[model samples]
Target: MATAYVDYFPLYIQTGIEAGLLDPELATFDLARLAAAIKPERDLDFAFLGLQTLYDRYLLHIDKTRFELPQAFFLRVAMGISLKEENREERALEFYELLSSFRFMSSTPTLFNSGTTRPQLSSCFLTTVDDDLSGIFAGIRNNALLAKYSGGLGNDWTPVRGIGAKIRGTNGESQGVVPFLKIANDTAVAVNQGGKRKGAVCAYLETWHMDIEEFLDLRKNTGDERRRTHDMNTANWVPDLFLQRVEAGGDWTLFSPDEVPDLHDLYGAAFATAYESYERAADRGEIRVFRRVKAVDLWRRMLTVLFETGHPWITFKDACNLRSPQQHDGVVHSSNLCTEITLNTTVDETAVCNLGSVNLVAHLTGTGLTAAGLDGELLRDTVKTAVRMLDNVIDVNFYTTPESERANQRHRPVGLGLMGFADALFALRIPYSSDAAVAFADSSMEQISYHAIEASSDLAAERGRYQTYDGSLWSQGILPIDSLELLRQARNGDLTVDTGKELDWDVLRVKVLRDGMRNSNVLAIAPTATISNICGVSQSIEPIYRNLFVKSNMSGEFTVANPYLVADLKARGLWDAVMVSDLKYHDGILSQIDRVPADLRELYATAFEMDPMWLIKAASRRQKWLDQAQSLNLYMSAPSGKALDELYRSAWRYGLKTTYYLRSQSATHVEKSTLQGTDGRLNAVPVAAAPVAATPTPAPVASPITTSAVPATPPAPAPEVPMDDSLLDAPAVCLIDDPDCEACQ
Candidate 1:
């Protein structure tokens, strides 16, 4: 075997010089000493798949030649962050340690393109346009510019007047929002994220718009291709009045924005009053044209399209506006891409959020609620730490556009969210639907929301408050918990907590008023699709999809199991050929297994077993504390339109701002095996039945019988190779011993 000891110090210095990431004079200082500072052994930590992903996409390569090493990558990121800091080297080293230890990481765009020329690091962008000819096309150009630089765009199209109202200036009937949306869609396709990924945009419309029916069909395959925005995402910015209509079975009126100018600006009770007044105006024949449909009927069609094509996610305008710290700034029109960020977007100000997710599984300690359960104290501490990390990211992140930089710097907004929530619950053996689990969800998120605010307040004490923090909720000493006081006042006519739990509202409120906060918005729950997988835990706050399933990565397909389940079954003498067959028969559910106790069954119900309502309820509980929104996913085993309607309506009633991904399982069932074989590949015999009244026994310390009984041993460690700097920023390496980590996907 050949050994290669390529010194990384000179390479780092050279790249820093070439990229202007460091001063050229620093390149000559103690090259050998810096080389000694690099830990070569960290190179051994890379799993084969992680290495492959890095080689394929992450590592900086010039004409198929790799120049930087793993340590070099970390150094580049650290250098990028500490470029303006006074103690640049010390800060750089501290950041390097954090990244190397996997304590925290920047967003994908940041990791991919930072420290390089034309660095475009923001992940999401929001834009709004007026209905006029130039204004509408100007929005399209803005989308192209942002997308060209690898930023996700969310455009608010509410100001665009609906189809066929009237244009007095032209003396002609208008073509409406749909025609403009189609042009916006094509621009998204044309400027495809600099070929890094797909050009992504989300078009948001107010529900009162006359062209909403056409907007809903933009992603439908049968629609006229010219009118469809198949490449872009669509969302309905629904107000509370629409929800009330759906709840009351009342008629919904749609009209052009020209006729109803203030509809988009008003919300909650005021919006309802204005909408009713508009309906009366239409009834009096004061408006040009109008159509009335059952609110529930419109909601059902929205859900049906969501389930069918997975576009136009549901976003609540009332909830967003009511809870926003920037509510005084303007009515929050829409959430950004992925529906996790709720910020004020306008024609001039394009809302931008710098996002980061905490690894919840990393904070788990055995002393608390075990690995699979909720630990409020640990969670609180972790959230505080995460808030600091995300706040730091805002200062460190490279902005692609001037608007995003300005917006981010003014608000200093940071989204501190979690990955591995479901995995954490699984480790604690708490069922997703149980009251204990729901209470834990509420308490845990409340702590995160509370401490995150406190952490930001502490940061403000040192660095000063965000530019727009003065008139915000935090300035009024109203934290998320204190906001709940307002809700309590609204509901019961008093700012009192009749509930038994003695929440520490007074302390948080006092701190906020005294210290203020560094950031306007501190917390949000984003859908951890790619990041969660890298963390090797359940994606955000969703139930386990399956006990055993295939995760297809670039390297190849690999079978992953629920680690907690594997451990539990092994201890109970229940993990065997027969158990595997039973689990396979039920599509990874252990609920129907006669031997598995009811408690364990409840604790480990798959996504199919837990009611979709439970997911919404849990989200609602968490939403109360979250200032922005949650990337909530509702899962149904065999979904009907009626079931989805109920789930969405309940979400709306509970004051959820945004809902992402309506994941419904098909009615298709796996075919049962009927093949006969003595070797038991297909026809394994069941063991003798245990006593019906058998008491639950504690799991064994370890299984004695090994390879003789089982056909396969545990997988071996992947091979190592010479360190490649290009692969350092790839996804985190997966530890083979921890199967629960796979749940993050």
Candidate 2:
């Protein structure tokens, strides 16, 4: 068969013209000429799986007919990014190169709706519902409108009266927040974004609310389906006081907002003091009714439901409020859909975030350095470029709802996140949980945060300060680094930094105060599921779930191994059938195998092998720098209620604004050989066995001593499992299968 090269630009123009979306006058630009500009050979770089993923989801289609090819998709995104540029064509081409070459990617919503007549370019939305009937329905209408425009919603339901609360207007008891949440849930289902994707919402409640327990159980499958909004997400807007109570093993008193007012507006020690006073009031019968439960017990139950149902994502009320650039404007009641965005959303305004991710792996120079071993200069440049790109996205994006537009324009919030962290770590041969690895995480993120703020400040010089920037911490010359003083205060029970290595915060703070900031909040770490796959990197900051597993991409199922792991083992002459069998026996853990060196074991520790505390700690360190929040997923093997309780409490103590997904391993591990019917045959013959000692319990590596300091020791190598094609090829879902799937996508 003869292969023919066809210019793809003309194809896109023709399709657009045929669909009546593109004007013939715009065709003055030669499609073939533009096509010549594209390197057709780049098309070959896409693996069958990557190509299929684009075809199935990324490509713009009209009724099963694809109008936008891969090249067209890149062009459209480029056009979207460069919509406001004076040198539009040049900027578009530059963006096209970055996108097509897989250097970076816009968020999925942008990919899905850009260049369309109605572009809903935002990723998340936050709204608040009023207590009155009309106001409540109005909130539902707002949710529907935002959802119709492809925005995820986070609703603050703390103001609504709880069950059995008095309704003055009706002169009767109220049905409380639960019934209203059910309506919100049904509405999310009813309006499904014109069938493009499920309508996503996260309902948030203050811990003081009486309906808190029921709210936490909404995601439980065993619960009354009517009371549950399994479709929507739930998060607890926890105050520091609650966490302190849990830590002190004190009692927690629950009260309706109607009875205990002003609790939502307080933070830190003030909030704790007020809460304790409220408990005393309730005990004295000053409050109508209340329930007292052991704080740890309540925390344990929260974890229990989370372990089973996967939600009520933990977000710190105090941290979110204290760090908010919009704090002077209003108290931020809750975060948006994915918990990465923390903005002030009220009855009048809905918070919006225009998000994009930098492909960290792309920054690695081709000097045979893996993504994990990215050159510092390359990483810094990528972050600087990405900060600029996200800033541009804020200006060029077309908002679907006025409230969202208003929120985004005033705050000018943008989330500059990362993808391929795991891949990068693998390339660097660094364990995700090691002190050295944590230092890298801290330094890299601090660099991004520092540069992102600097970039926004530069934009502020060009444009003007954000609408609400006047009274912000930025205006006070308080950089995110300066906020460390607050954290040190919280950590040490007083404001003092005993730790050495003074950050260059004073300088950055001075610079920020002088220049102002273009955006109110500049940095957030989102779970870049689809974008990561597009860049062929690991998802977000998560570790690899397995070295070898079956990833069902759009093309079909294929086995994907950690390329770095495979290459390293191949170099060691240990890539063989027996090693594969060991991996199977160990459930993808490599530490127990004696053949694997200590260095590799430390470097290649799977998510389960790495302690949950390490994940929380790393996120905490990064959180100190981030103005908004992070999509930090905590992984645990055989997780208990107590384990989860401690994990979340620790997160709260560390002042993390938000926590995203809580993924736990099932108790029973499915031996791959048993599933594939090869177990008996594989184990029938006894091979030469290394006398292996019992697996040692991995200790939590201490936090990095300094922001820029490197650890003294390199990560130990993970033990080698004898390789078997069958075991290595175990089947699992690829992240791109459903780009809109809530789990990974």
Using TM-score, give the best candidate's number: 2
lDDT (tens digit, per residue) of candidate 1 on 1-745: 0023235567767775786544564553445544555666656554333445455545676665766666667666665655556666665666666555444455556556555655555667777787788888878887888877667778899988888889999888988888888888888778876665567778899888999989888988886888887777788998867866666678899999988988878876678789899899999999886889988778767766776666678898877877788776777888877788888876777787766666555555454324433455755655655565556656766565566677888888877777677765665555676655666667667767777888888989978999988889888876665465444333233221213234677887888889889998888877655555443456678788776554554445444456567556766777766666676566667877897767668667887777776677667678878888887766766656555665676676566778876665542232344323432223222233221110112332211111122113211111211222232221221111222111111
The Cα local distance difference test for each model comes to 0.66, 0.68
Encode model 2's per-residue lDDT on 410-524: one tens digit a residue. Answer: 8888888777777655555556876656666676677677778888888788777888899888998877666666655644552212122234766777778888998888888
Stretches of model 2 off by over 4 angstroms after superposition: 1-6, 20-36, 280-284, 370-373, 487-507, 551-558, 576-587, 592-598, 667-745
How many Å off is the CA of 88 in candidate 2?
Answer: 0.9
Worst 10-residue lDDT window for candidate 1 reads: 702-711
The count of residue-pair clashes in candidate 1 stands at 12
Compute each candidate's TM-score over C-alphas.
Answer: 0.82, 0.85
